[model samples]
Target chain A: MTTAKSQRTVFFVSDRTGITAELLGKTLLTQFPGIEFLKRTFPFVDSVDKAKSVLAKIHDTAQKEDRPPIVFSTLINEEVRAALASDRALIIDLFADFIRRLETELGQESTHALGLSHGIGDELVYQKRMDALNYTLSHDDGMHTANYDRADVILVGVSRTGKTPTCLYLAMQYGICAANYPLTPDDFNELALPKPLQPQRAKLHGLTIQPERLAKIRHERKPESRYASLENCQGEIRAAEALLRQAHIPILDTSSMSIEEIAISILYGTGLIKRVKT
Target chain B: MTTAKSQRTVFFVSDRTGITAELLGKTLLTQFPGIEFLKRTFPFVDSVDKAKSVLAKIHDTAQKEDRPPIVFSTLINEEVRAALASDRALIIDLFADFIRRLETELGQESTHALGLSHGIGDELVYQKRMDALNYTLSHDDGMHTANYDRADVILVGVSRTGKTPTCLYLAMQYGICAANYPLTPDDFNELALPKPLQPQRAKLHGLTIQPERLAKIRHERKPESRYASLENCQGEIRAAEALLRQAHIPILDTSSMSIEEIAISILYGTGLIKRVKT
Candidate 1:
């Protein structure tokens, strides 16, 4: 059995994808550590009936738990937002709280539009993002080096040190074309920059992880293999770091960072954020 | 020269990745269609010195433009936030506005942690997301049908109907293991579910696009080829729609939708969001 004070139901409601509401709500919720928040998201809730149903669900959960729920909403439609009003829950309407101030500051009436954030705002921008995704995919893992000139940033790292996901994240989130090259055991033996990366020195950034963590990650894919040995992991990382440092390339230790953090760090370290429109 | 009222500079400042601030700020700015916002983001502004530099940059831009810049910040540190304060711009501090209300409601003090939102929260959750990304990558474009049983959702669509990016987005954002199969001419002739997909009927979702849009997209990849012809696009889309209808698979038309929108709609259509923890 759970106590009412320790357990809470939270809802993220929005007219569109509810991504902003979820992101902000989750960030705020992370502040309180002990409470367990069971989250539910209601996306595309653009109608009064949908909002009313969400309100009913909130009330039902409150009744069952003997405590009120918390609702983080980005509902732009007035009637639909009104339908979700309830005294039983802590309703934080994000847009309603900020839009009025923005209107007053900007000295204009807001369009009161729905789902503009996730919509295809500019056709050229959307196309560029799609193109960037394709570029990153085709250039993944040193698959195509002919297009290295087009890459915004090229990541050099040992396998399982977080390269592919970070590249994909850069392309997906910022529409930046990123390519990655995996440093192999053979390259470690030579302790020199890979031939293909030599010409793209200015775009190169290195990622290295702790040897224990690298071994664990590699062991997940290939258990008990020589490649997953801690000694091998340590040797490879040492060689890779030496080569990257010799070349004067910036390196990021990704042992404790998320993909978002790694991507953002690369963007800032390489000064590529200046070129990224998003 | 652009009028001062018609153009304004916008800045997204944060102690971490600045993604949440940019997302929420952009959503708010979209309401004012006539104004053009030149945007910049300053991530990792955790120190007072860094925040002061950003403030100076904002003031410089304001002076050059003869209009105050709009600053959207998610800085959690009080000293850093205070250093960023200035009368030259409209600074909308997201954390400052809502954290107080949340603290009052929860009856608890916030950890006031820097970069918690984008940080690697739980090791298991982070591992799941990385595993999901690896799964989606390996299953891309029907590469590994042997793992269809493990997929959360299998997307079937003709080439260039926005399958690959949508799959990547679902995996990266929601940690959903999405697999996509590109429907070819042979599949259209059979008008039956692919052999590998027959057992995974419950996980199947279909994507369609307007013939003109499909033609344009194909043309971008392989210009002047028969694959980019309008006749071929129309034939493929019609056959794909008919086949999906026969299978009773839910379909989404991706003519004007963004990748985020397409991904969210698919999650809702397939009820996969229930399985996704994040």
Candidate 2:
């Protein structure tokens, strides 16, 4: 008999904000979207009724289709676990995997601890940021760069090339003050580098996203305009890339890559440190 | 001998465009202000020397002081990492964590990846938002009071009380069709509910940020105007709360919580399925 027709989909459910799971999952799913990964997020499905809905979705989906859907669930409750377990699907429980490893490797109680959602890392990240800001305030006027001077690298790109988000993440995740800049029309036209950028030509890193995505972002603010026009964005992006190439600057296409992936690429490609997860 | 000060002071350095990190990090750092965290981002640290200046800041901080500073850098490449990871401080690499996890989990070597940038969730989040907007477009009326019939849960609050940000976040994060309307002077003067709001009081969730916080946020925009004045914000906030309390509607505070946290509260309070992160 032919294999049961399998409908593959990915779900991000979390007791807390499903951000971490969604984020982590996005990266993982990108590597396997052919499975028809349809992403659905259910936040705070803890109560019996809410939990029942989760069960019902799985049950109903299982009964209707030829093959069970590949269900990826992040549940922190035992009852919900029991309810969901009844479904005939390849369930990838986030906690189950991480917790098992933690218990096995660290000999520590992984329950409610290793949770990326409930992890101390979030708190640590928050505190670390506060201290960082205060420190920056005291060490103003570009002086703070001395310590971060270790940043053998910083990113320079146009307005929507995913620079800031990438940098903050780099800083927060690794304590890397990954600096970034936007190429203004002036800079793009003049093609003359800023004084600081001049000496760093060899060290310059650039990121470029798909023009369509950039336009999509710009549309939110000033809908229906040349600035937000696909053609304009594409032209500007293409021109910028050509200029960077001419300048002999190596650039990364941020179109398909996530911020995490981009950061790693810059680190490794540029001969940066041993890829350590900060 | 006294314990040697650890090079534990963390620093976040970025280029001038590093404003991205500052704004993103500002929100994150409020939770922890004691971590000796440092931020030094120069948009122009483009050269080897510029990068060196940044490195020196870290080196000097670590070397000059009894306590060595921990440099969390986001620059791309071995060049900066090599320069920055001097004898004085610990270099916490940001891009490495996600890459390592990705390589370990995905089994395939990762290309350039951006570890985790909080602001970058927009694209994925907005992907599902079209369904929400369309659903709301077809479902909502001006009064929007059909609590049970609402395309999604409704949010009501005084002006500048954070209804907008919360709703945008909900729409972005959970694919939840969230619509927000200020409980304006008219909402108060009429002392009667809007046509749409009256029917869906149960489905109508209320968001109340601390009056002081509301004042602070409004002040940033209006800057001393009556609308943004602390007195106005507090007054509006109080009256709005009175109305909601009178209606016996459940309320959530948006002041202390982040967009993520507030979204979670709504998902849980409304009994919506959380997107599990698997």
Candidate 3:
């Protein structure tokens, strides 16, 4: 039976966003990396018709493939969830399993509503996140230096080194007021921090990338320009690293890291307290 | 004993980003809303020294509080994990519990490594996400209309209705190429679809907000302007919703919704396929 299948199929089925299922499924599948898994997300599977269609797809895959498809679901509705379950596939209803256990343990029944997990249940928390996102956006790339005191962290990096996205992620996910300053070629000439950043050196976190990767990323943006050349990338990276080292500022290499990793690392290294809770 | 404390303290600790711990902890805590949770995150506690400090804080909180502090941790280092455990508090080691079960099920010993879950193990996936983010940022607020064909989803909403951040969230999280177009008063005069959106109606999703909420959000940015008046907001939203309803386009109210909730609802309502997986 093991030899019969070349790869297994996995589905993240949800009544709403399907993000929770995806995160949980991804974490579990990372453990069994040797076995390849084909993944798909089916969100808003709230209706009986949609649930039947999902079940049909699962049964079809089971018949054609040797291994039973693994399903990770967060459907809160009992009728819709019941329609999607079968002996033909290995279905794990995360909500149903955990909600029952939690209800018994807490001596209360769950609301079993759809789309509440990621909702704005608390208005104040939601507003704080929005305010942080706006602050991050307006202060991006050192657009306004007057509000430096309000920033929890300021990211300094060469352009296209995942600075903007990482700052935005930190703000959106954790209600962190993050602002990024681009380390321009002009700054490399002196290998000194910008005057605007001099007073706030304590809040500055640096990001650097591998020279080759930096060149490739720049090449995509401005192909055949001197700014995207390998030599230019190498020189800029070297100077930036030297400046960061000289200033005794901590830096992160983002060449092989995701935005989540970079944001978390900055939070960890800086000890910045999150403004809002998830 | 329960009445002794008005609020319970919860800590999400991790050796890496602490995002997974926070996410899992948030999900579990949502089940028990009766007890207020005062949550804090301590990320990248990889060393014994850091773990010791974390334990000391937990113990101190226990001493001062009427109830034991609850800690949800995802530390992978054996020694560091051991240092964080204390008899004075309730500690749940999420990684140790799951990794062992996964190892036994997969018939392979776990790596027990730190900061691996959010790593850029798949370079292609990372690049795709970066590309999507760039596309979303550049195409924000109908900046450039030439690349509308490249978008998987195009959000339509009146100004300040939260089209920009929602687009960014969709792109950054799911690698969906999301573009947002603002429905200016010029287009609302006829209560018809914008010219650029008519050709791609299937990819279009509408966002509307309550008039009072929209006025308040705009008032924060530009107070005492006609644009921030409740009458202007009510007129704009009424016209926008009429256009969307006339065309049978799916619409969502963003007044009380989070960005994640909006993105997921759009994906579900439109059946938009995610361009990248976690």
Instruction: Give interface RMSD for all predictions.
Output: 3.3, 10.4, 3.6
Which pairs of residues collide in candidate 1? none
TM-score of chain A of each: 0.95, 0.56, 0.84
Q: What is the per-residue lDDT of model 2 for residues A2-44, given as tens digits with 9 covering 90 to 100? A: 2333235555666556665565455444433223455666666
Candidate 1: Cα lDDT at A163: 93
Candidate with better TM-score, 2 vs 3 = 3
Ranking by DockQ: 1, 3, 2
> Which residue pairs clash in candidate 3?
none
Clashes of 2: 77
Better lDDT candidate (2, 3)? 3
True lDDT of residue A107, candidate 1 = 75
Candidate 1 lDDT, tens digit per residue, A20-83?
Answer: 9999999988888867889988989999999999999999998998878999999888899999
How does residue A270 of candidate 1 score in lDDT? Answer: 74
Q: What C-alpha lDDT do the candidate models reach, one value each?
A: 0.89, 0.56, 0.81
Span of 10 residues, lowest total lDDT, candidate 2 chain A: A133-142
Comparison by TM-score, 1 against 3, better one: 1
Give me the runs in candidate 2 sitting further than 4 Å from their true place. Answer: A1-13, A18-42, A45-71, A76-90, A111-124, A127-155, A159-182, A188-191, A194-205, A208-251, A255-278, B1-205, B210-236, B243-251, B255-258, B264-278
Assign candidate 1 its CAPRI class: medium
Error of 2 at B65 (Å): 27
Which residue ranges in model 3 land beyond 4 Å of their true spot? Answer: A1-5, A13-16, A40-68, A74-116, A189-191, A245-248, A274-278, B45-68, B75-89, B93-116, B246-248, B274-278
Best by DockQ: 1
